[model samples]
Target: EDRLLPLSVEISEIEALGGPLLLHSWREGIDDVDNDGEADEWEYSIMREITPMKENGTVKIDFPSLELVANGEFGKVSLYITGTDLAGHPVLNGGAPGVDNDMATLVTQDDLPTTISQPSISLDRWGNNLLVGQIHEFSFSLTDDNGIGSIDNISIALAPGDSRGDIWLDPLSRELSVNDNSPIHPVGLVIDELAAGSYKVKIQFRLGVDSPQSWNTSTQKPSVIVTEHGQVLELGSNSLSHLEWTVDGRVNLMLLSADDLSPPHSELFGNTLYLQPDDRFNFSGQLHHPANGLNVILDGDWQVNFSMDDNQNNAENWYTILSDSSSFMATSEIPQSRWNHGSATVQATIVGGVQTIPITDMKLHIVIDSTPPQLDFPVTTLSTINSNQMMQQLVTIRVNEAGGMGQNPLELHWSFRRHGVEISNMHGAAQLPLATDAEGLWTYSTRIDFDVNSDLLLPGDDLVIWVVGADLAGHPLEGIGTEGNSKMTQLRVIYFQPVLSELTVSPYQPTIESVFTIDGRVLNEGNDMGVVKVGLWAWQSSGNGGRYHILNETNLTLLPQQHAFFTFSQEAWDSGDLQLYIAINDDDTNLTSVPVGLVREQTTGEILWQNIDSPAAVGLMILLISVVLMVVTAAIRRSDEEWDDMDEEEIPPPPPWAPDEWPEGAGPPPEILTQSTSLLEEE
Candidate 1:
């Protein structure tokens, strides 16, 4: 072991090295701080004192200046001593307290490296896949260096694992050299050679050492997926996670699983699927097949990968397949033909089973020519309809046969007649415009005027407007005999004849009940034939010889000069002379006929309704008389008995006494009581 040497620094020299050096004695109570955990300002001044070597080269030296070192930090002091002419001696060897060597320097550095980071990895699905030559693409990124620095060549080895697919590169570079150091590596990725089956594609980036500070990333790897042909599909609108496409006919489909080593399992989106016999590139459009047709399968929800390769030389062609099972690819070379209808089969691959859905036999007939004709209304009824009451409202008629309803060459001829009279003599064929609907649908309205008199009324003359139209083939789809054009309506017309409809009597007859049947008829002179109901009236002459009294009414319906009989209760009146008045009215026609006189058949009942009163009176009189007679007889009998009780003499004597009692001067002779003399003589 070598002897210890004393180190010191001159105060002036300390100031030269950036700043003053801190120095302090090794003694106790050398508190350089205010006790506030911080060095006092004065402590800084003490640092200016850099100790030097003592008298001799050999001396006892202590590094007491260490106290001036910063707190919570370490301080290092190197010793550089210059020996005076004398050689430096070992301490305790009769040397001075300090020995100076050469100069000393201290250096420090802040913020040293501590921790290292690992890059992150991510994965996502490329869009959908194509049917035959489909390309499976994936995007990859990383956060940590693989081995030593940023990865450069990303060599992806996609082994179908168990899937079957031919990897393909479509016009783009397959070997991705991501050494450009962009924030986002390889903006795009495309995987070719995809087959039907589950796959485990291993992706590794060839790491390149770009900088001495670059980290090694040889161990970091990315993940990619390539689905099979028919097993995978994409539903354009639905967010289905899994989709399976089933093929039909001479073709079959197989599901190719994603690379097993890939981070995320491969999924087939079903909602993005669009299967049509038409172009596969256009997904959100209607597909029409003239020949082999198209088919589509809608799997509920299940991840399915597909693979297919077919060269059917039919009109139907196969477009791209979707990523999920919800949609599939149709591989047909059939073009749009002139078939009335075509059919196709759509198959869906499901977890538990598979579905084969058949398309329509053929698409609907689409009229390609959209040329529509214009329609004007010289006589056409306005879209706004109004209620009219006057003679059948006569709306003028006009039609431009040329520019009518469709692009196909067509002609129209029309004729109008009112009340069986053809009125087209004035303005026969008024030219009109084409239909208003852009679709070119034929346009005709119920706007005919039969009566020339009333604008607010429907023509009453049984007006008829005849229309005749013919196609380019001379196939007339109009006219009276046309399958669909002949229509008829009654113009402002009326039932000219009148028929008695109803005639009824009040209270029915009381004593003699009778019902009379009145038959009558009327002629129908109107252009339109219809039923007319007419009412009749009857009046009877009172027995008092006064004017005739109304009795009852009858009604009947007459059909064009036809007659009818109406009968009502004749029991309403007694037999008497009655005048018959016939009134006929057509309710629907709103026309009333004049009252006509009809011969009255006399109805007679000798026993008027009042006969009931006479019988009742006779009965009451007989009962009164009987009662009075019985009372009178009882009184007479009583009186006779009383008389018998009294003597006859008493009665006679009472009468003579009254005569003699007459005033004395009034009677010259008084009749004597002869009853007593006669009784004496007889005795």
Candidate 2:
């Protein structure tokens, strides 16, 4: 059975003793799958991952099971325990000799790493002829089944020019050899120390193997094409932070490599930046500068500036920023007052020690606004108008500015909604560009009409009409009132009927042969129907002065609240009395034919108005006329008898009804005969 053991060795012999680590104590990446502080029994599993690098010295990794990643470019690599973390440096089975190198575990645990089934080596750059005194860089990648685990020693094994050195090699690059007692050179360089002749180099390195103190001395002759001149590196195009970088020009910029480090850290690719009000802007990027014939880093102080085309006076504004140190970081902020309340195109230009580049495609926008319009509706005058008679009443509207931005003439709109429903149904729409009168109010002479055939309006329907106003900036009236804008009072169309009243006639007292005029008014108390016809007539004495006759008749038309006048001139053919009457046809709506009468005598003073729709007065007037005719006949006989001297003898006996048979002392032989001597009645 295996048991734990304690061991110790000088730090200088650590490299040699770690060759058989699987047989001795530890072999790098051995771990405890279960957490217990002490190493757990575990077997090594081979993994290969192409870890990405930033601009620092180390790379961060999420998991060690990178068994699926293909070989990609990277820098220095180390080993890690599956469940073990490098914390307070607890000695694992006995601590690794190098405190700073605890991540390089080889002489601690007893788990053996998997052997390299296939070996491969790759070179990213080379030149057959190189500048004599120049420091040339070569990126050589080595691989085995378990990967180059925490490289312990790297040496050169040349057959001809060996260590004791018959030929010289650049000590700068040769320093990558494990022969040096210092740290390893990550970006190994080869200084030309040999003569201008061909030479062979076989590089061998030792790292963690399957057993403790057991090592694999893998060897490879990396192709070295050192050039005196003429060598080009093709790094096509790349993009970062919304800016596209084209490295095809004579002065192209490339992103070399990056690693994990602390603040002042740099990135080969720029960082994403988001800008907003009251927030500082922070951004960064690192790029490789180009030389005439060398693929190398150009490091120096850089000037970064930002410009916004949409800002006010933008042509004179430029913001200077900083990107200092090897890990360059260009950072700046946008002032709150600098916002233009509009979209703009932004650009950031980085002036490196050797070149200048303008990054395009940055867009931003800003805005600050809030408020509504003020409105007031005043009282109108014209009222008591008939329904459907055009609500043509005077209306007053007043408005103020919107959002404190002065009057909104160009952006204003108006609408008239009824009962809080469809405006179109009410024959209305949102008329844009504000329709206002000279006083800035909407003086709309509103009229309501309904076609009983197709319109939706109904009589006596309570219709609420509203006039709404708004601005293009989305400012509607405040509270808009409960009913909104303007409302209509109760209005309804109704039936019309003519009612006549207030009759007047000129010349209340008239003389014979004089003229008189009669006047009356007709009112449409209901909905208007049409004109009304009023006829005028009168009763007067006949030419014989014995009976009354209807004469002087005429007609007139009157509208609602209109006056009908009748003018007539009469000559007194003989002394008599007259009666005048007026009437309207009773067949039409609200029409009546009650005759109005007036009585006047040619010799009397006053005129009398009497309603005469009876036959009693007609019978009395006929009796009086008969008495006058009898008297006239008696007189005519007397005149004839006197003229011819034989009338009374020849004449027949008087009728008993005649006054002639009365006693001589009778009252003046009947008053009618005395009154009717020779005069006739006039009307």
Candidate 3:
């Protein structure tokens, strides 16, 4: 048999067969169906009485199933209908074993999708607030069709358009490089140690096949919100979200009264504030109250108010100062009874929620010292400083101690007064440094200078300045005006400042024996006229430091801006630098000069320095030359005397008479002739 006979049975009856129905299947080649090595044969089983066929003549059989993990070989599978209740049943065989009818395609989970789009990026924490020095971490969560390749960049900037910040970063991939084979998609941002302020965070992303510009964030949501550590800071992606940070320390502030609108804070007083009439001021600085425990708000805005009493006698006239809530004024309204009179006291109380705190030692006492403040100045010390800096008027003002940094009620209010009123706008109200004394009084001192339009001071017209002793509150020191020791007013005598100009030497670099002229003009740089001396002087830089003489001078009275010229002549001196100088108004006082120098004489001159025109130096040279000439003349006379001695005279007499032997015959005749001539000459 071929083992391929056709078989048919009732579909309903065959499906009821729950037992295993064996098929007579056989293979030609070896197939390890059971996973064991060798090939095996199938056992043939009987036929079954199945249900009858339907209209299409298709029989259905319910065959019990068995699960198998064997790998079937590509061999033939046959079925035969044998003896049974329903005989001649043919069981058909399939073309091949272990083959699926419908083909399947491979699918990968990580591969990029057909259509690419932008990734949705965001932070894990929605809250973005933090402490000033605290470090925190958040994530840049991203989701896309191709997954995240990398984060291109991230940056932080101050909110409200402040670009000066610390959070600028590039390629914030957070180790998400393609080469490392590590799964890096979500980028984490770790913020550490930020200055307390409002800041914003932004970022860009890199996805496969898409540039950062092409990435889409139309569907991104704001998630991160940072808070609790300090101020509330919100963190959002794709858009701007700011972080509000605050420091942990407390803050300081100051508030003045109604009249003084500008807050002096620590500029005037340490812990207390001084107020004048109609003064209105404000307080602006860091403020904080220590937290009692966890979950307590340390930074609380409290309602503060100022109260004052008419007298230190503990009277019942305490009144609240009425002021604008936005102003730095500690009080809303100051009762006239407190500040209008002297010797009044004031304090401030703060109401923070249910807690009330009264700060003490913030005393405001009225001042009433009848005597004006005394001004002391060492005239000699002040005169040496640059008069031009003092506006050509020497003035050293020291307000008598008003309790040093802490001005008590008895302090002096020293100021420049004009037209019977204090000139508060002197150089735009300059702030001077404070000096502390042993008596615990603080004083302020300064120099006044009005550079322009100083022609205001006429002759003998005193520049009036006032020094009044008063408390911070409006009371002035009262005293009888004394003639010489008047405490309240000081009159400075303005002297005309003589400024020497046009200072020059005719021959700038003078040669030896050459005459040079020193010319200068004196101009009164000050307001009034005074007697000023203009002089020409020279410094011989020959090992002399201060030894210089004024060769010429002229005393003259110069009015303001009026000038006069004085000139002098002198012969050039010294080969080295000759300091030729001219000055005005420097007689018997600190000298100032415009000096010119002459190069030292080298070739035309000798080694020593000399006013080449000076007769003493020339005479010394002539005397030495004369002495050398006299010595040479004496030597010549001695030589002449020696030459005369060497000459031979007609030494005839001795020789003719004494010679007897060699020229015996001629000797007698020569001797007779010599004796005859000698006798004749003698006679």
Supply the TM-score for candidate 3: 0.26
- Candidate 2 residue lDDT tens string, 94-126: 223222433433232222222211122222222
lDDT of each: 0.31, 0.34, 0.38
Would you give me the overall lDDT of model 3?
0.38
TM-scores of the candidates are: 0.23, 0.23, 0.26
Tens digits of per-residue lDDT for model 3, 367-482 = 32222334454444233322234453433334343422243322222233456454444322223344444463344554545443333433333233333344343334333321
lDDT of 1 by residue, 475-569 (tens): 23433422254334333333244434444443222223334444334555433345544444444346786442334444433455554555433
Ranking of models by lDDT: 3, 2, 1
User: Model 3, 105: alpha-carbon shift in Å?
Assistant: 36
On TM-score, who's better, 1 or 3? 3
lDDT-best of 1 and 2: 2
Query: How far is 607's C-alpha from truth in model 2 (Å)?
Result: 42
Winning model by TM-score: 3
By summed lDDT, which 10 consecutive residues of candidate 2 come out lowest? 207-216
Give the runs in model 3 whose Cα sits over 4 Å from its true position. 1-129, 132-139, 144-270, 276-330, 333-398, 401-683
